[model samples]
Target chain A: DVKVTQSSRYLVKRTGEKVFLECVQDMDHENMFWYRQDPGLGLRLIYFSYDVKMKEKGDIPEGYSVSREKKERFSLILESASTNQTSMYLCASSYGELREQYFGPGTRLTVT
Target chain B: AQSVTQLDSQVPVFEEAPVELRCNYSSSVSVYLFWYVQYPNQGLQLLLKYLSGSTLVKGINGFEAEFNKSQTSFHLRKPSVHISDTAEYFCAVRPGSNMLTFGGGTRLMVKP
Candidate 1:
């Protein structure tokens, strides 16, 4: 089975604190994505990386940034966390030709 | 850009009851559709996908969805649902682009 792993399962941060959520995939997939899930709104893409060091903004990327230094790792960064940024974050990876994506265990972030 | 709409916000049904989750997509061009399920505190899992070929697509957990191009809808149906079927279902579309746009999810609550 393809496995995607997130560094943290739950996190709590104070306002203005810097936060990082890490994701790693073992399938050597070329595409990786970051999303935040909220009630009723489903999952909104925050950012995605098609290749190393390359990123594109998703529907909601205002207070978030991402890093893809290597093919196996993708990281989500909150420059300065706010209470509104509290949400469940998910990471996914997919092969270049496949339409299906494998996801990691989500990180429930609570920024107080 | 591609977008998806899932009409039902929450559907509560009894165990062993048939269920249908509706989805529709709008885009200027062609697109691919997918259904994903997310359990509480877990990541999203690919329930099914429609890339090409036949319209009816069967997926894991006895769930299936049919792609109706004329109607621009892909509705998920299950003959019977169990308590384990309780989860949030998301409809997504990829419009000849790398990014996948997801709909606001529909939460399925199966009662005993």
Candidate 2:
């Protein structure tokens, strides 16, 4: 079974604080993604990395940035967290050309 | 650009009854379709996917989805649902790009 693990299941942060969400996949997948899931709105892609140090912007990438310095790790960074940034963050990875993504448990971020 | 639309926001069904969650997509080129289930406080899990050959794809937990190219729809179905089947369902479409476009999502509530 493919395993994707997130750093935290729940996190609370004050406004203007920097927040980092980490994800690690054991499957040696080449594609990793970060998404924010809101009620009714479903999941919106925040950022994705096709290869190490390579990134692409998604639909809602304004308030979020991502890093993939290593093949197995992907990190989501909130430069300065805000109340509106609170949501369920998910990390996923897929092997090259397969396009079937496996997801981590998710991190519920609460920006106060 | 590819976009997905889940026609129903929520579907309530009695235990052991049939259920269906509707999804549709709009894209200029060929696309891949997927259905994912997200339990409470958990990340999304792949239920089924339609890449090419077959139109009807079966997934775990006795769930299945049929891809209708002419209608541009991929609707999920289950002959009978259980309490454990309650969750949010998301339909996603991937065009030529590596990124995926997800639908608004449909919440399935199974009553006893």
Candidate 1, TM-score vs. the true structure?
A: 0.97
- Checking candidate 2 for backbone clashes, the offending pairs are none
The C-alpha stretches of model 2 lying farther than 4 A from their native spots are none
Query: How well is each residue in B1-112 modelled by candidate 1, as lDDT tens digits?
Result: 6778999999999999999999999988988899999998889999999998999999999999999999999999999999999999999998876588899999999999
Clashes of 2: 0
Query: Which pairs, if any, clash in model 1?
Result: none
lDDT scores for all predictions? 0.93, 0.93
| lDDT (Cα, tens digit) per residue for candidate 2, span B1-112 | 7789999999999999999999999998988999999998778999999898989999999999999999999999999999999999999998865578899999999999
Candidate 2 scores an iRMS of: 1.3
Candidate 2, residue A54: CA error in Å?
1.3
Candidate 2 lDDT (Cα, 0 to 1):
0.93
Residue B47 lDDT, candidate 1, scale 0-100: 95
